[model samples]
Target: MARKPKLAVWKFSSCDGCQLSLLDCEDELLALAGNIEIANFLEASREVIKGPYDLSLVEGSITTPHDLKRIQEVRKISKFLVTIGACATAGGIQALRNFQSVSDFISIVYATPEYISTLEQSTAISSHVKVDFELHGCPINKEQLVEVISAFLFHRKPNIPAHSVCMECKLAGNVCILVSNGVACLGPVTHAGCGALCPSYNRGCFGCYGAKENTNTSSLSNKLYQLGVKNQDIQKLFRSYNAYTPAFLKESKAHD
Candidate 1:
Protein backbone atom coordinates (compact mmCIF):
# COMPACT_ATOMS: atom_id res chain seq x y z
CA MET A 1 0.00 0.00 0.00
CA ALA A 2 1.13 3.56 -0.66
CA ARG A 3 2.27 5.58 2.37
CA LYS A 4 -0.35 8.06 3.59
CA PRO A 5 0.81 11.64 3.23
CA LYS A 6 2.38 12.88 6.48
CA LEU A 7 0.59 15.89 8.04
CA ALA A 8 1.88 18.16 10.78
CA VAL A 9 0.27 21.02 12.71
CA TRP A 10 2.49 23.69 14.31
CA LYS A 11 1.89 26.58 16.69
CA PHE A 12 4.03 29.67 17.23
CA SER A 13 2.48 32.51 19.29
CA SER A 14 -1.30 32.20 18.93
CA CYS A 15 -4.31 31.32 21.12
CA ASP A 16 -4.37 27.71 19.73
CA GLY A 17 -7.91 28.35 18.50
CA CYS A 18 -7.01 27.46 14.92
CA GLN A 19 -5.62 24.06 16.00
CA LEU A 20 -8.82 23.40 17.94
CA SER A 21 -10.80 24.14 14.75
CA LEU A 22 -9.21 21.03 13.22
CA LEU A 23 -10.18 18.86 16.23
CA ASP A 24 -13.68 20.36 16.09
CA CYS A 25 -13.97 18.72 12.68
CA GLU A 26 -14.98 15.61 14.71
CA ASP A 27 -16.55 13.44 11.98
CA GLU A 28 -14.53 14.76 9.06
CA LEU A 29 -11.36 14.51 11.18
CA LEU A 30 -12.03 10.81 11.82
CA ALA A 31 -12.31 10.24 8.08
CA LEU A 32 -9.21 12.38 7.44
CA ALA A 33 -7.24 10.37 10.02
CA GLY A 34 -7.97 7.21 8.01
CA ASN A 35 -6.22 8.72 5.00
CA ILE A 36 -3.38 10.85 6.42
CA GLU A 37 -0.60 10.31 8.92
CA ILE A 38 -0.96 13.04 11.57
CA ALA A 39 2.76 13.21 12.17
CA ASN A 40 3.08 15.99 14.77
CA PHE A 41 0.20 17.70 16.52
CA LEU A 42 0.97 18.34 20.20
CA GLU A 43 -2.57 19.55 21.00
CA ALA A 44 -4.18 16.38 19.58
CA SER A 45 -1.49 13.84 20.52
CA ARG A 46 1.69 13.87 22.59
CA GLU A 47 3.23 11.29 20.27
CA VAL A 48 5.97 13.13 18.33
CA ILE A 49 6.32 11.53 14.92
CA LYS A 50 9.40 12.56 12.93
CA GLY A 51 9.30 14.75 9.81
CA PRO A 52 9.85 15.66 6.67
CA TYR A 53 6.10 16.09 6.62
CA ASP A 54 4.23 16.29 3.28
CA LEU A 55 1.99 19.13 4.45
CA SER A 56 2.18 21.45 7.45
CA LEU A 57 -0.60 23.64 8.86
CA VAL A 58 0.99 26.47 10.85
CA GLU A 59 -0.72 28.81 13.31
CA GLY A 60 0.32 32.10 14.99
CA SER A 61 2.68 34.96 14.17
CA ILE A 62 6.43 35.30 14.73
CA THR A 63 6.66 37.23 18.01
CA THR A 64 10.03 36.20 19.41
CA PRO A 65 13.60 35.30 18.48
CA HIS A 66 12.84 31.63 19.19
CA ASP A 67 9.77 31.78 16.91
CA LEU A 68 11.97 33.15 14.13
CA LYS A 69 14.40 30.19 14.34
CA ARG A 70 11.73 27.52 14.83
CA ILE A 71 9.66 28.57 11.76
CA GLN A 72 12.75 28.33 9.52
CA GLU A 73 13.28 24.78 10.76
CA VAL A 74 9.61 23.92 10.13
CA ARG A 75 9.80 25.29 6.58
CA LYS A 76 12.94 23.26 5.87
CA ILE A 77 11.18 20.03 6.87
CA SER A 78 7.74 20.56 5.30
CA LYS A 79 7.15 20.21 1.56
CA PHE A 80 4.00 22.38 1.65
CA LEU A 81 3.35 24.98 4.37
CA VAL A 82 -0.07 26.63 4.86
CA THR A 83 -0.60 29.36 7.43
CA ILE A 84 -3.93 29.26 9.31
CA GLY A 85 -5.97 32.05 11.00
CA ALA A 86 -5.36 35.78 11.52
CA CYS A 87 -2.31 35.22 13.69
CA ALA A 88 -0.38 33.06 11.22
CA THR A 89 -1.49 34.94 8.10
CA ALA A 90 -1.66 38.58 9.28
CA GLY A 91 -0.12 38.89 12.78
CA GLY A 92 -3.52 38.87 14.67
CA ILE A 93 -4.77 41.17 17.45
CA GLN A 94 -1.34 41.22 19.09
CA ALA A 95 -0.08 43.02 16.00
CA LEU A 96 -1.74 46.16 17.45
CA ARG A 97 1.51 46.65 19.35
CA ASN A 98 3.28 47.17 16.03
CA PHE A 99 2.03 50.77 16.10
CA GLN A 100 3.33 51.42 19.63
CA SER A 101 6.55 51.01 21.57
CA VAL A 102 7.14 47.36 22.59
CA SER A 103 9.71 48.33 25.25
CA ASP A 104 7.35 50.72 27.01
CA PHE A 105 4.54 48.14 27.05
CA ILE A 106 6.90 45.44 28.33
CA SER A 107 8.12 47.69 31.17
CA ILE A 108 4.50 48.45 32.16
CA VAL A 109 3.04 44.96 31.73
CA TYR A 110 5.97 42.79 32.89
CA ALA A 111 7.44 43.15 36.39
CA THR A 112 10.86 42.64 34.85
CA PRO A 113 11.28 43.84 31.28
CA GLU A 114 14.76 42.29 31.03
CA TYR A 115 13.24 38.80 31.38
CA ILE A 116 11.01 39.33 28.35
CA SER A 117 12.85 38.51 25.13
CA THR A 118 10.67 39.27 22.11
CA LEU A 119 10.70 40.82 18.67
CA GLU A 120 9.74 44.50 18.26
CA GLN A 121 6.68 43.52 16.25
CA SER A 122 4.36 40.53 15.87
CA THR A 123 4.61 39.41 12.18
CA ALA A 124 2.87 36.84 9.97
CA ILE A 125 4.53 33.54 8.94
CA SER A 126 4.83 34.78 5.33
CA SER A 127 6.91 37.73 6.57
CA HIS A 128 9.61 35.19 7.52
CA VAL A 129 9.12 32.20 5.19
CA LYS A 130 7.57 31.07 1.89
CA VAL A 131 3.91 30.26 2.65
CA ASP A 132 2.14 27.99 0.14
CA PHE A 133 -1.32 29.15 1.27
CA GLU A 134 -2.95 31.44 3.85
CA LEU A 135 -6.28 30.62 5.51
CA HIS A 136 -7.58 33.87 7.02
CA GLY A 137 -9.95 34.32 10.00
CA CYS A 138 -9.70 35.04 13.74
CA PRO A 139 -10.18 31.33 14.62
CA ILE A 140 -10.93 30.31 11.01
CA ASN A 141 -14.11 28.68 9.63
CA LYS A 142 -13.81 24.91 10.30
CA GLU A 143 -15.32 24.03 6.91
CA GLN A 144 -12.76 26.21 5.14
CA LEU A 145 -9.94 24.63 7.13
CA VAL A 146 -11.07 21.18 5.96
CA GLU A 147 -11.20 22.41 2.36
CA VAL A 148 -7.63 23.75 2.61
CA ILE A 149 -6.29 20.41 3.89
CA SER A 150 -8.31 18.49 1.34
CA ALA A 151 -7.04 20.76 -1.47
CA PHE A 152 -3.44 20.03 -0.46
CA LEU A 153 -4.13 16.30 -0.24
CA PHE A 154 -5.63 16.35 -3.74
CA HIS A 155 -3.02 18.75 -5.19
CA ARG A 156 -5.55 21.47 -6.11
CA LYS A 157 -6.36 25.04 -5.09
CA PRO A 158 -8.53 25.56 -2.01
CA ASN A 159 -12.03 26.76 -2.90
CA ILE A 160 -12.01 29.65 -0.44
CA PRO A 161 -13.69 32.87 -1.63
CA ALA A 162 -11.94 36.20 -2.15
CA HIS A 163 -15.16 38.21 -2.05
CA SER A 164 -16.10 40.88 0.50
CA VAL A 165 -18.44 40.32 3.47
CA CYS A 166 -20.96 42.63 1.78
CA MET A 167 -21.56 39.86 -0.77
CA GLU A 168 -22.34 37.43 2.02
CA CYS A 169 -24.67 39.98 3.65
CA LYS A 170 -26.55 40.39 0.36
CA LEU A 171 -26.73 36.62 -0.19
CA ALA A 172 -28.06 36.07 3.34
CA GLY A 173 -30.65 38.83 2.86
CA ASN A 174 -29.34 40.94 5.73
CA VAL A 175 -30.34 44.57 5.73
CA CYS A 176 -27.51 47.07 5.12
CA ILE A 177 -26.84 48.42 8.59
CA LEU A 178 -24.43 51.00 7.20
CA VAL A 179 -27.04 52.43 4.85
CA SER A 180 -30.19 52.01 6.99
CA ASN A 181 -28.90 52.85 10.50
CA GLY A 182 -25.74 54.73 9.41
CA VAL A 183 -23.67 52.21 11.38
CA ALA A 184 -19.89 52.02 11.07
CA CYS A 185 -19.07 48.71 9.36
CA LEU A 186 -16.00 47.05 7.87
CA GLY A 187 -18.01 44.58 5.83
CA PRO A 188 -17.50 46.55 2.60
CA VAL A 189 -13.80 45.64 2.52
CA THR A 190 -13.49 42.69 4.92
CA HIS A 191 -13.18 39.13 3.62
CA ALA A 192 -16.20 36.82 3.41
CA GLY A 193 -16.06 33.68 5.63
CA CYS A 194 -18.06 34.20 8.81
CA GLY A 195 -21.29 34.26 6.72
CA ALA A 196 -21.85 37.93 7.62
CA LEU A 197 -22.69 36.71 11.14
CA CYS A 198 -22.66 40.12 12.83
CA PRO A 199 -24.68 41.90 10.12
CA SER A 200 -27.20 39.04 10.08
CA TYR A 201 -28.00 40.05 13.66
CA ASN A 202 -28.08 43.80 12.86
CA ARG A 203 -24.51 44.52 13.95
CA GLY A 204 -21.48 45.61 11.94
CA CYS A 205 -18.60 43.34 10.91
CA PHE A 206 -15.38 43.53 12.96
CA GLY A 207 -13.27 42.23 10.05
CA CYS A 208 -12.06 39.06 11.81
CA TYR A 209 -11.31 37.44 8.45
CA GLY A 210 -8.94 40.19 7.20
CA ALA A 211 -9.18 42.18 3.93
CA LYS A 212 -10.65 40.86 0.70
CA GLU A 213 -8.78 40.99 -2.60
CA ASN A 214 -8.52 44.49 -4.16
CA THR A 215 -10.32 46.10 -1.21
CA ASN A 216 -11.23 49.77 -1.55
CA THR A 217 -10.70 50.66 2.10
CA SER A 218 -10.34 54.36 1.24
CA SER A 219 -13.84 54.46 -0.19
CA LEU A 220 -15.19 52.53 2.80
CA SER A 221 -13.45 54.90 5.23
CA ASN A 222 -14.98 57.88 3.45
CA LYS A 223 -18.39 56.28 3.72
CA LEU A 224 -17.89 55.66 7.46
CA TYR A 225 -16.89 59.31 7.87
CA GLN A 226 -20.08 60.36 6.08
CA LEU A 227 -22.00 58.14 8.52
CA GLY A 228 -20.63 60.19 11.49
CA VAL A 229 -17.82 57.78 12.44
CA LYS A 230 -14.96 59.83 13.85
CA ASN A 231 -11.49 59.52 12.29
CA GLN A 232 -10.06 57.91 15.43
CA ASP A 233 -12.93 55.39 15.54
CA ILE A 234 -12.36 54.60 11.87
CA GLN A 235 -8.67 54.01 12.64
CA LYS A 236 -9.55 51.65 15.49
CA LEU A 237 -11.98 49.79 13.23
CA PHE A 238 -9.27 48.79 10.77
CA ARG A 239 -6.82 48.01 13.56
CA SER A 240 -8.84 45.24 15.13
CA TYR A 241 -8.47 41.47 14.41
CA ASN A 242 -6.49 41.65 11.15
CA ALA A 243 -4.75 44.99 11.70
CA TYR A 244 -1.31 43.99 10.46
CA THR A 245 -2.53 42.94 7.03
CA PRO A 246 -1.27 45.36 4.38
CA ALA A 247 -4.65 46.62 3.17
CA PHE A 248 -6.03 47.26 6.68
CA LEU A 249 -2.68 48.46 8.05
CA LYS A 250 -2.26 51.06 5.32
CA GLU A 251 -5.84 52.28 5.77
CA SER A 252 -5.48 52.44 9.57
CA LYS A 253 -2.26 54.45 9.23
CA ALA A 254 -3.97 56.88 6.86
CA HIS A 255 -6.56 57.72 9.53
CA ASP A 256 -3.86 58.20 12.18
Candidate 2:
Protein backbone atom coordinates (compact mmCIF):
# COMPACT_ATOMS: atom_id res chain seq x y z
CA MET A 1 0.00 0.00 0.00
CA ALA A 2 1.26 3.47 -0.85
CA ARG A 3 1.44 5.46 2.38
CA LYS A 4 -0.06 8.93 2.48
CA PRO A 5 2.42 11.78 2.18
CA LYS A 6 3.07 13.73 5.39
CA LEU A 7 2.44 17.48 5.57
CA ALA A 8 3.93 19.93 8.07
CA VAL A 9 3.28 23.64 8.67
CA TRP A 10 5.67 26.04 10.45
CA LYS A 11 5.43 29.66 11.58
CA PHE A 12 7.98 32.30 12.58
CA SER A 13 7.58 36.09 12.95
CA SER A 14 4.09 36.70 11.52
CA CYS A 15 0.46 37.40 12.37
CA ASP A 16 -0.57 33.76 11.73
CA GLY A 17 -3.22 35.02 9.30
CA CYS A 18 -1.71 32.90 6.53
CA GLN A 19 -2.04 29.76 8.66
CA LEU A 20 -5.67 30.73 9.32
CA SER A 21 -6.15 30.83 5.56
CA LEU A 22 -5.53 27.09 5.65
CA LEU A 23 -8.25 26.60 8.26
CA ASP A 24 -10.47 28.96 6.31
CA CYS A 25 -10.34 26.35 3.53
CA GLU A 26 -13.02 24.60 5.65
CA ASP A 27 -14.36 22.27 2.96
CA GLU A 28 -11.23 21.87 0.88
CA LEU A 29 -9.26 21.05 4.05
CA LEU A 30 -11.65 18.18 4.81
CA ALA A 31 -11.08 16.75 1.33
CA LEU A 32 -7.35 17.36 1.67
CA ALA A 33 -7.25 15.46 4.98
CA GLY A 34 -8.36 12.33 3.08
CA ASN A 35 -5.19 12.36 0.97
CA ILE A 36 -2.35 13.36 3.31
CA GLU A 37 -1.21 12.98 6.88
CA ILE A 38 -1.16 16.44 8.47
CA ALA A 39 1.74 15.55 10.74
CA ASN A 40 2.55 18.90 12.29
CA PHE A 41 0.25 21.93 12.26
CA LEU A 42 0.00 23.59 15.67
CA GLU A 43 -2.99 25.68 14.66
CA ALA A 44 -4.94 22.70 13.25
CA SER A 45 -3.59 19.95 15.53
CA ARG A 46 -1.27 19.98 18.53
CA GLU A 47 -0.08 16.38 18.20
CA VAL A 48 3.21 16.89 16.39
CA ILE A 49 4.79 13.78 14.90
CA LYS A 50 8.51 13.80 14.09
CA GLY A 51 9.25 14.55 10.50
CA PRO A 52 11.13 13.85 7.41
CA TYR A 53 7.95 15.44 6.03
CA ASP A 54 6.94 15.08 2.38
CA LEU A 55 5.73 18.70 2.15
CA SER A 56 6.09 21.74 4.40
CA LEU A 57 4.20 25.03 4.26
CA VAL A 58 6.27 27.64 6.10
CA GLU A 59 4.81 31.05 6.96
CA GLY A 60 6.58 34.12 8.35
CA SER A 61 9.96 35.85 8.17
CA ILE A 62 13.19 35.13 10.02
CA THR A 63 13.18 37.81 12.73
CA THR A 64 15.47 36.23 15.30
CA PRO A 65 18.52 33.97 15.58
CA HIS A 66 16.22 31.18 16.85
CA ASP A 67 14.09 31.38 13.69
CA LEU A 68 17.23 31.29 11.57
CA LYS A 69 18.30 28.04 13.19
CA ARG A 70 14.75 26.60 13.13
CA ILE A 71 14.18 27.19 9.39
CA GLN A 72 17.48 25.43 8.58
CA GLU A 73 16.19 22.42 10.52
CA VAL A 74 12.89 22.62 8.62
CA ARG A 75 14.72 22.66 5.26
CA LYS A 76 16.57 19.54 6.32
CA ILE A 77 13.37 17.60 7.10
CA SER A 78 10.95 18.65 4.38
CA LYS A 79 11.36 17.14 0.91
CA PHE A 80 9.39 20.05 -0.56
CA LEU A 81 9.43 23.45 1.17
CA VAL A 82 6.91 26.11 0.12
CA THR A 83 6.93 29.51 1.80
CA ILE A 84 3.47 31.03 2.15
CA GLY A 85 2.49 34.73 2.45
CA ALA A 86 4.40 38.02 2.33
CA CYS A 87 6.16 37.31 5.64
CA ALA A 88 7.73 34.12 4.33
CA THR A 89 8.18 35.26 0.71
CA ALA A 90 9.15 38.97 1.11
CA GLY A 91 8.84 39.69 4.83
CA GLY A 92 5.51 41.06 6.15
CA ILE A 93 4.59 44.40 7.74
CA GLN A 94 7.24 43.63 10.36
CA ALA A 95 9.87 44.14 7.70
CA LEU A 96 9.49 47.84 8.51
CA ARG A 97 12.01 47.13 11.27
CA ASN A 98 14.62 46.55 8.59
CA PHE A 99 14.72 50.26 7.78
CA GLN A 100 15.56 51.37 11.34
CA SER A 101 17.42 50.13 14.38
CA VAL A 102 15.82 47.22 16.27
CA SER A 103 17.09 48.73 19.54
CA ASP A 104 15.17 51.94 18.88
CA PHE A 105 12.00 49.99 18.03
CA ILE A 106 12.30 47.78 21.07
CA SER A 107 12.83 50.78 23.37
CA ILE A 108 9.62 52.42 22.11
CA VAL A 109 7.48 49.25 22.16
CA TYR A 110 8.70 47.49 25.26
CA ALA A 111 8.90 48.87 28.78
CA THR A 112 11.58 46.26 29.55
CA PRO A 113 13.47 46.55 26.27
CA GLU A 114 16.34 44.46 27.62
CA TYR A 115 14.13 41.36 27.62
CA ILE A 116 13.37 41.68 23.90
CA SER A 117 15.50 39.27 21.94
CA THR A 118 15.48 39.75 18.17
CA LEU A 119 17.55 40.39 15.09
CA GLU A 120 18.07 43.77 13.41
CA GLN A 121 16.25 42.80 10.22
CA SER A 122 13.23 40.81 9.15
CA THR A 123 13.92 38.66 6.08
CA ALA A 124 12.21 36.07 3.87
CA ILE A 125 12.80 32.32 4.30
CA SER A 126 14.37 32.12 0.85
CA SER A 127 17.11 34.41 2.21
CA HIS A 128 18.05 31.61 4.61
CA VAL A 129 17.22 28.35 2.80
CA LYS A 130 16.49 26.81 -0.60
CA VAL A 131 12.71 27.17 -1.04
CA ASP A 132 10.96 25.14 -3.75
CA PHE A 133 8.14 27.69 -4.16
CA GLU A 134 6.84 30.92 -2.65
CA LEU A 135 3.20 32.03 -2.35
CA HIS A 136 2.93 35.75 -1.62
CA GLY A 137 0.25 37.81 0.20
CA CYS A 138 -0.24 39.67 3.51
CA PRO A 139 -2.79 37.10 4.55
CA ILE A 140 -2.66 34.81 1.54
CA ASN A 141 -5.81 34.18 -0.52
CA LYS A 142 -7.30 30.79 0.37
CA GLU A 143 -7.90 29.73 -3.26
CA GLN A 144 -4.25 30.33 -4.07
CA LEU A 145 -3.18 28.41 -0.97
CA VAL A 146 -5.26 25.44 -2.16
CA GLU A 147 -3.77 25.69 -5.64
CA VAL A 148 -0.24 25.61 -4.17
CA ILE A 149 -0.93 22.54 -2.01
CA SER A 150 -2.80 20.76 -4.80
CA ALA A 151 0.09 21.40 -7.16
CA PHE A 152 2.49 19.85 -4.63
CA LEU A 153 0.20 16.86 -4.11
CA PHE A 154 0.07 16.23 -7.86
CA HIS A 155 3.79 16.91 -8.41
CA ARG A 156 3.00 19.71 -10.89
CA LYS A 157 3.49 23.42 -11.11
CA PRO A 158 0.76 25.60 -9.59
CA ASN A 159 -1.22 27.66 -12.10
CA ILE A 160 -0.82 30.90 -10.13
CA PRO A 161 -0.62 34.14 -12.14
CA ALA A 162 2.44 36.35 -12.15
CA HIS A 163 0.49 39.30 -13.57
CA SER A 164 -0.24 42.60 -11.86
CA VAL A 165 -3.47 43.39 -10.00
CA CYS A 166 -4.31 45.76 -12.86
CA MET A 167 -5.07 42.68 -14.97
CA GLU A 168 -7.60 41.51 -12.40
CA CYS A 169 -9.14 45.00 -12.19
CA LYS A 170 -9.59 45.01 -15.99
CA LEU A 171 -11.04 41.48 -15.92
CA ALA A 172 -13.59 42.54 -13.30
CA GLY A 173 -14.68 45.36 -15.62
CA ASN A 174 -13.67 47.93 -13.02
CA VAL A 175 -12.50 51.32 -14.15
CA CYS A 176 -8.89 52.18 -13.31
CA ILE A 177 -9.12 54.18 -10.06
CA LEU A 178 -5.96 56.08 -10.94
CA VAL A 179 -7.41 57.06 -14.32
CA SER A 180 -11.10 57.53 -13.44
CA ASN A 181 -10.99 58.83 -9.85
CA GLY A 182 -7.49 60.32 -9.86
CA VAL A 183 -6.46 58.05 -7.01
CA ALA A 184 -2.92 56.84 -6.29
CA CYS A 185 -2.84 53.05 -6.61
CA LEU A 186 -0.32 50.21 -6.56
CA GLY A 187 -2.52 47.99 -8.74
CA PRO A 188 -0.25 48.64 -11.69
CA VAL A 189 2.65 47.01 -9.85
CA THR A 190 1.06 44.79 -7.18
CA HIS A 191 0.61 41.06 -7.79
CA ALA A 192 -2.74 39.55 -8.83
CA GLY A 193 -4.48 37.17 -6.34
CA CYS A 194 -7.00 39.09 -4.27
CA GLY A 195 -9.23 39.47 -7.38
CA ALA A 196 -8.68 43.26 -7.28
CA LEU A 197 -10.87 43.50 -4.17
CA CYS A 198 -9.90 47.00 -3.03
CA PRO A 199 -10.07 48.50 -6.52
CA SER A 200 -13.52 46.96 -6.99
CA TYR A 201 -14.63 48.96 -3.94
CA ASN A 202 -13.30 52.17 -5.53
CA ARG A 203 -10.22 52.18 -3.28
CA GLY A 204 -6.58 51.97 -4.27
CA CYS A 205 -4.62 48.75 -3.92
CA PHE A 206 -2.43 48.73 -0.77
CA GLY A 207 -0.22 45.93 -2.19
CA CYS A 208 -1.50 43.12 0.03
CA TYR A 209 0.22 40.77 -2.36
CA GLY A 210 3.91 41.45 -3.08
CA ALA A 211 5.33 43.09 -6.21
CA LYS A 212 4.35 41.56 -9.54
CA GLU A 213 7.04 40.37 -11.92
CA ASN A 214 8.66 43.18 -13.97
CA THR A 215 7.15 45.78 -11.64
CA ASN A 216 8.04 49.39 -12.43
CA THR A 217 7.78 51.11 -9.05
CA SER A 218 9.72 54.18 -10.25
CA SER A 219 7.11 54.87 -12.94
CA LEU A 220 4.28 54.23 -10.48
CA SER A 221 5.88 56.56 -7.90
CA ASN A 222 6.13 59.30 -10.52
CA LYS A 223 2.44 58.84 -11.33
CA LEU A 224 1.54 59.07 -7.65
CA TYR A 225 3.63 62.23 -7.27
CA GLN A 226 1.82 63.71 -10.27
CA LEU A 227 -1.47 62.92 -8.51
CA GLY A 228 -0.28 65.15 -5.61
CA VAL A 229 0.39 62.23 -3.26
CA LYS A 230 2.88 63.27 -0.59
CA ASN A 231 6.39 61.82 -0.75
CA GLN A 232 5.98 60.58 2.86
CA ASP A 233 2.69 58.88 1.93
CA ILE A 234 4.33 57.41 -1.15
CA GLN A 235 7.09 56.08 1.06
CA LYS A 236 4.50 54.74 3.49
CA LEU A 237 2.67 53.12 0.58
CA PHE A 238 5.63 51.00 -0.46
CA ARG A 239 6.67 50.40 3.16
CA SER A 240 3.55 48.50 4.09
CA TYR A 241 2.82 44.75 3.89
CA ASN A 242 5.47 43.56 1.43
CA ALA A 243 7.78 46.43 2.38
CA TYR A 244 11.10 44.62 2.10
CA THR A 245 10.50 43.08 -1.32
CA PRO A 246 13.40 44.16 -3.57
CA ALA A 247 11.25 46.19 -5.98
CA PHE A 248 9.30 48.02 -3.26
CA LEU A 249 12.39 48.51 -1.06
CA LYS A 250 14.40 50.06 -3.84
CA GLU A 251 11.56 52.39 -4.83
CA SER A 252 10.78 53.37 -1.23
CA LYS A 253 14.42 54.30 -0.65
CA ALA A 254 14.57 56.27 -3.90
CA HIS A 255 11.77 58.49 -2.54
CA ASP A 256 13.95 59.35 0.48
Candidate 2, which ten residues in sequence have the lowest lDDT sum?
Answer: 29-38
Q: Estimate each model's TM-score.
A: 0.97, 0.97
lDDT tens digits, residue span 1-256, model 2: 5888999999999999999999999989888898888999999888998999999999999999899899999999999999999999998899998888899888899999988889999999999999999998888999999998888888899988989999999999999989989988999999999999999999999999989999999999999999999999999999999999999999999988
Please give the distance, in angstroms, between residue 12's alpha carbon in candidate 2 and its true position after superposition.
0.2
Highest-scoring model, lDDT: 1
Clashes in each model (backbone N, CA, C under 3 Å)? 0, 0
- List the global CA lDDT of all models: 0.94, 0.93
Candidate 1 Cα lDDT to native: 0.94
